[model samples]
Target: MSPNLAWRPIRFTPQLERTYVQCMTPRIILLQRLACIIGIASFVGYQFWDLLLDPEALPRTAPIRLAIIAMFAVVLVITFVPSLRTPRYLMIQYIVVYTLLGIGWSLILAKLPNGFLAGVSGFLLGMIFIPVLVNGAMQAAVILTPLVLGPLLVMTLAGATRLEIVNAFSWIVGGAGFAVGFAYLLDVINRHAFQLEQLLEAEKTRSEKLLLNVLPAEIAERLKAGEEPLADHCGSVTVLFADLVGFTELSRKLRANDLVNLLNDLFSRFDNLVEQHRAEKIKTIGDAYMAAAGLSGNKRDHVAAIADLALDMRMAFVEFCQDHHLELKLRIGVHSGEVVAGVIGRQKFAYDLWGDTVNVASRMESGGLPDEIQISAETKELLPARYRVVPRGEIEIKGHLQRMTYFLQGGV
Candidate 1:
């Protein structure tokens, strides 16, 4: 099987793109520093070797020494100067000055006795390992040209024998081939590493966004940090359930896509209201939307917050129905009590609430009339004096005994 066939490509989001760009500058700078150190140190080492080998040759090679110093100055500017530190700028400096330095070294060798034994081929091989400095194939080829041919050109001009010239030419060809091949391999490896980093970042961002959608921010973070079997007891939390009236019959009249779109539009409006009131939306089942306040912390004003959310939802539905020329009504029910909330299931897990509080809240919505907000007696007690709630008398609820319910009228 093809490797690409099994690999699922991740989409690089805008945030990940910015992260990649931010990462690139520092990585390039690090490689440039490494290259500068290696290049400079090698030149110094070669100069010392030449001195130890042929001390008399130094006076004759004064021009060559000056050329090496000039190359050193160029490298310093490319390394320490901020403007000339980029790959493009450094590439230009290396191509021009380093090439000339290679020619000067060749001239120095041609002037000395037993010049071939100094091993100038080793210098040509060092050109392959400059990391980020030699970024492209063309740049590598340019740097190799002088280092490869300069020796033979100088030997020819200095009247070397045919056998000596032929032997040096063979060494030059071998060194140049190895340098070019190594440069290409390094280029491939560096590019592959960069791409792998980008893909990993993209995957991380996608996972975080998916987790946040399923759980609250605080809970998602805890789960990411390896918290398991997540569960919590929330006391004095308010649970609100809002269901769309007449949606079942409406669905029968419209196509599947149209019905889905309508539900998405209505639920999306309710979602905005939940956000505005700082209430966490639990999940939507069919046409019903569930939310809770104080379950995810911030319990001081949970009752008032849920109350505000219900009112906003009522207004949003009114406006939405008016704009769409539809006659949809919203029935919202709220109750305040103790409940156990937690994340469950190892695969496709969901954050959900349990206990009598959740059960009674659902009953309040199912038992209530259309176009109104209903509240259990427990929720009514939590409201402030400024808000108005009228008793609906004792109403028998399914799966439970008779309990007092109230209608939540408009607040002052």
Candidate 2:
């Protein structure tokens, strides 16, 4: 059977995994300490009663007291020792040392004249609480098995009364069954909660990714922060607009899917070039692609970056048409000036530029020839010294007056 087709494994993310190890584990160690303290306190209080009534039993009680103390000291070290506090060590300590301690105490109690109560209580205490300290159901069961059975066997062999034997056996079986069942229930709940947390976290990440793809990172953050009327004045920026020439004619001839595929293929390449030059792709409207530079706050190189982007996009458009056996052309126009750029409208957020600069950039594209980079004079001045541009004497733009334009010839 293939791995993908096999049962899916439960995987916890780093945060959920850490919650179990770093956060939950320490608290469990504290629970173990509490359990030990309560057992010791109860036993000591009972023994004190005996001490006040009859001081003669101290000789036999001394060894049992010392054994309890020794067991506690060992557990204390395992609980707090930096190296031994790990889940694995805690489980091992419970299974091996704790079980031995239980057996040793039971042996001492059975040897005593009247010690059946103490021995049975100790066995039940360890069986019931060991599961609360360790994490897994299996580990809890492993620890409870020896801790419960070892003491009962010792009491039976040490000449415990028949009534005492029956009582010890009942407590052992009942406590073991309860501990195992309760631990498994808690384990199931923990796993279910971990899985739920992972799913919610994964969905949050996927939503954030989709938001970033739609808006610029900064804008997306602002929106998430509950900022409204998002707007910014980009003091000086460069905008490039490219319209696919012959798209109208090709749309009439090509099938619907074929036309969409062609457009998607060409625009995908253009998008890469825009990203390569650190430009913000404003939006793609129909067959027109708009992008800007300097909006990222570092305005010093926007002009040169947009120029490079326009050139690369021109080459990409040509190569895409050739690869797919189609005749297509890109008319790109670039302009540099101040403009207001921001996410506009609440229903559907669209990051766009406004002002004469945007309009002039659009005009440059409309007036541009096929397979040419038409640039306004503002952008032409900012071109690097190595770039070659040919001036196109003043042209009459629709709404704007006469403007000096140039064709951005190939660069060095």
Candidate 3:
């Protein structure tokens, strides 16, 4: 069977227009429609009343009052068209169109000797304000004032059976006065809207950066999209466990605030070392600090990176204690193997590591003595020429068999 020619295409009708309008932001759509309707209604009412009541007595001298009516109808139709929806682009169209509307209506009033029917005058003077409110008084004036003035001057030359040479000029001056007043209000609204949009964009960017700092970049993206992916990514990471050996004595000697400040200062130095080696800071629980390279994020040569960080932390603490006339000892243990690390809690989030490697590394720290840097035999083989190490006889690591460990001094 052939396709039915009667159903070739359904054109966009009033029903389709209404459906589209409903889908747009209702408030802005309603206000723009209402403003346009009010202008058109007032213009029609005056045109009808003047032409019907007494065409001869009516003060208009325009040979083409029908043309002015058509202009206003076109303006109202343009306001609701979907093409004028781009905020930036539509704003330009709005400014140009309303500017012309303001000038054109002012000219129609100018052709009348008395310059506006009392009720229509109020609306014409009042409704001609959207442009001024949206752009600026000066801008609306510069764009529109001339379009109205020249047209009005020509319309004023029309005669009510030869009344125009003297009477219509007075109406032109009065119409110009109303345009100036309405244009000022338009400028205020324009400036205010622009400022608000700029501020909103700045706040959005600042919030994005703050989120990246709080959560890793990948986690932040998942949060924005409302997905809670597995936070842990398992891998063979190098874990480092460090603690102050004399934490008890250090806390006892200093005031509570001073102890906290000292810990903060010591940890701050350690944080720099960790970053320098591109490691993830696992958490500082009390005087104990834990870090790992290559978990929750990627790394190259994870074991060597962590060993360098551990050595730097040890030296930094020694220098800190010596400079302050306080004795500080650091026991750091590093192990390279498979482990799981992730943020574990909802509130007061903590990044923690799990698995046998984390346990063995912690045991190496607990088994270590004052001022010593210890590591698993697995970790020792990755060391470069910068660190010194000596084999420590097999030490029993909790939950595991006795494993040979090493003490890190300077370089091996």
Candidate 4:
């Protein structure tokens, strides 16, 4: 039998709506500016019409034409004012500009000889062009209503014939229908583009997170910045290596999934400790976990940070064992010295550390007893006086000279 699934309804939440608006604000501002420029040009250019079509009426119409031009100018100035450029203010400015223009043009056309025909032509032009400025069909309807009806009313009052008024009305309605449809189509296209941009942003964030998980944040940024064969040499660094005791034998007795689950639970706790101490987890090899401090160039107290991380890992492992009802122990070893760190590999690349420090740290873990935090003399000398340590004498390290080491017990 199939299990029942709960599904969330798909809709644009308020947050998404606000985001869409914000994304489209620049485009809206540009359109508003374009509209203003066109309005200004049309008014200025029609001065020739005033001279040609009806020179006698220019004296009376000039003030109305200048007034409409001044209104468009005011709105255009508002668009450049950062404080005044909000969605609400832009909407108000849009309505005011177009409404005043519609009214102003209607008055001017009414004074002409062929007033009815002139008004109808003006109405048709407004219906075809004005809707592109606003976003939705409803807003287009609101702005177009005044533009369409004001001229018709003026023409009717001016004694236009019934046939002339009817013909103009049909043309006005058809133009409005076309304007509303165009606005709706633009609205749909803008929304789809907004959603696509949002998806791309989300994917970019996810990819960055995954990259950070594999590499240190600084190294990841350098890689992203196109730094090829990235590497850095540090004079001082503290490295830690930890291995789970008895994990090999325990894995043989448990199922693969169970074994992995148990390892993951313990390592997750260690990861938290690493973060708390501000140390970087280098990588894990089988049951072993490696970490480092001072890779970010903090050479002063990296040893103490790694020491605190090792101590905390032991305590966390104890709690983990008790909860899982398993017999397990953590063996941690630390060493402080210079090393080379960088990203390596063409495919499946990783950030790693190399040199004597990392190897000595690994040997400290392998040579040390279970449930103990071991440190080389170099690391021990750097710890604060509050930490209590006991000498473990000297041990012969494979492929290296014998070195004095100590077991880090606790703070005094």
Candidate 5:
């Protein structure tokens, strides 16, 4: 029994997608086959009529005439119908076209008097053309050569067949053969074209999903199409960095997947916080996360954005600790300065900022006390008095000669 119905409610399956494709493929193939059959029937019908009435011939008696029409009809049915598109139908078409051609043309040629050799030649030459498949140019050559040259070649060479109309119908066989072959060829081209297009659409869908995974939709599009910021932009933005203090110990206590899930959960919440303040997240390095604001097209007010986010994170982490009973703390640092920012990379591209301002922002986080928010003096200059600023005293930040730092405790 199929498991699809049993598990259908739990997950989606490829079977549904396949069902739609299945209905379409055969319907189209059938249509093309039908058109090929109809075209062949019309060409052969006109030829049979014209040939039977030719004045210079032993007239078509019922048996011979009936045989010729019957043979042609069978060939047309088998060759051009969708039912015959399969291998079984192909065998039937080949048997009919060749057998009828041999019997009918031989009879007509035998009566041509001096036409014997030309008829033989036409039969042999036609065999060479109708069977071999090549480009459309070859098909045209096959049909037209017989029409214009049948009498010329046979009569001019062997001096036979005074009936110009008989010669014309002889050549019309070439046209009929070419028409059938050409129609078949066109359908082949159409099917291949559709397959190519389907592959491209699949690729486009996969690419969209990947882009969504890497960056937010709006940002990814601007970066994808090579759009650039209007000017060499500058921004006063808040940068925030968060790192787990002893994740190595946490890793030792949990499975690899557990640690990964924990990190994913933690960072996802952090991302939500960044969004809540309309900030842009930069990147995450394992247990570390970096985010910034004002560079997301904001030329100013980064300090305020970072400040507000820093307070929210501290409160959220406190609540998380209480609920999960997991001891947790975050060191958040905020700095505001003009940073040179732009996008980078071709594959897995990212937008980033460089310059002393962004560097100072990272240092503030590292220099911060766990459970506290740290801000550089430059950041303090712009912040409102709703937050109490505690001077951490002048200290040497790593890789810096000297710097002043302060703690932004909540409002007094």
Candidate 6:
């Protein structure tokens, strides 16, 4: 997962090493079982060779073969031990047991009649099969070199001809070289696949985060689940709209980048407040921010949450203005009613609301006084008695007759 754990020629980070071991452990266990079964069968079957080639050698080798079979049985049983089943521990066990098995085979070969020829053939097969049992080139070499040279050394001490030694050396080294090359290729391919998988996982995480930022969590999941025309009739929701007072004139005076920076700073604070109060920020239009509560789950206190969010937004905007040395005001409007909320657009998707409640909330912001939070009668009725409100009665709302409104002052 981290760059530091990327594959290297000789050494690997602990994370990569653990991952490799985890991936290979089951395969290794299977191969170990197969090896044990084959080794037992061949050792039992080879008693005929002892009878035909050298009757004198039978008594000497029979017990040794039985002992080796017992050892193979022990190794096979170790694989099933629950305590030793971790990846690293199992790998270590495999290496140790396999190396010992190679040694045992070498000793058995040395005991047979015309043992030099038999040892040469046996060691050649081992060198060829080493890569499949082990993972990396270095690991293959570790098992291979000792098995190859150890038997040759034993044969030399047993007074083998120089020609026999030379022939065995040539064949064993050639096979080991080929096996090591194949092991290296396998390592490279495995590492590439691992890196690709990590990249894909990271990309999926980023896409999900971006989607969550664009839409509410519930809506995003619905879209992901192939729910088309995603819409809901919210019977009770409190919507809040806040617009920066005189931002149009301020934008005219400031540079484009400065204007954007100012809006970003101010709205970023509003975003934090929305999160703190458990409200879903619908979207921002220029200097105006829209958010709603009770759009997702059962939040019976949605009105109170939106009211607290609006008050916090007013305070946060005041602090932002002081920090930036500007005289600015925020006009926030609150209204509670039914609305149709859904995801709109196929390309640049938007989660928005459509209903008379949304229109009335917007009109509350547009028609309200600067530096104040305005609320429709529906919202005012839901507020706790702790909050202070004064009637702004009979305001002329756009596309509607005069309606009762109130200015939300502050908590008593």
Point to the candidate with the largest TM-score.
4
TM accuracy, model 6: 0.80
Distance from true location, Cα of 280 in model 1, Å? 2.1
Candidate 2 Cα misplacement greater than 4 A, ranges:
1-90, 104-114, 122-136
TM-score of each candidate structure, all chains considered together: 0.76, 0.80, 0.60, 0.92, 0.49, 0.80
Note the Cα lDDT for every prediction shown: 0.78, 0.79, 0.64, 0.83, 0.61, 0.81
Give the clashing residue pairs of candidate 3, or none.
132-186, 132-187, 133-186, 136-187, 387-410, 387-411, 387-412, 388-410, 388-411, 388-412
Tens digits of per-residue lDDT for model 2, 348-397: 77778898889989999989999999999999888887888999889989
Could you give candidate 6's per-residue lDDT for residues 154-181 as a string of tens digits? 6677677787778777877787788888
lDDT of 4 by residue, 39-108 (tens): 7898888776766668797887889989988988888888889888877877776666667766788677
In candidate 2, position 313 carries an lDDT of: 88
lDDT of 1 by residue, 1-412 (tens): 3666323323346786455434555666666566656666766666666777688766777667666766665676656677776556656776776567666777777766767645656555456554345644556788778766776787788887787677777777776677666666655555556678767988999999889878989899988888988999898899999998888888899999988898889889988888889889999999999999998666688999999899889999999899888988899999999999999998999999999999999999988989889999999888887788888888888888999999998788
Candidate 5 colliding pairs, count: 3
The C-alpha local distance difference test score for the whole of candidate 3 amounts to 0.64
Candidate 3 segments whose C-alpha is farther than 4 A from its true place:
1-138, 141-144, 157-215, 223-225, 228-233, 383-388, 409-412
Write model 5 residue lDDT over 1-412, tens digit each, in one string.
2654332222214673354334344653454345345434543553453355554454533344456656655654554555656543443454445455445555555454444444444543434433232223343343334444443444344444456435545554555565556544553454445556767989999998777556655677776687865223565666777776666676788888877887777777877888888787878877778888877564366667777777887887777667656766788877887777666776556666687877888888887788878888888998877778899978678778778889887754
lDDT of 3 at 112: 48
For all candidates, the clash counts are 0, 0, 10, 0, 3, 0
Model 6 steric clash pairs:
none
- Model 2: which ten-residue window has the lowest total lDDT? 3-12
Stretches off by above 4 angstroms in model 4 are: 1-11, 115-132
Candidate 1 accuracy as TM-score: 0.76
Runs in model 1 with CA error above 4 Å? Answer: 1-25, 55-84, 100-104, 107-111, 130-132, 142-178, 188-200, 252-257, 298-300, 323-325, 377-406, 410-412
Error of 4 at 329 (Å): 1.1
Model 4, TM vs. native:
0.92
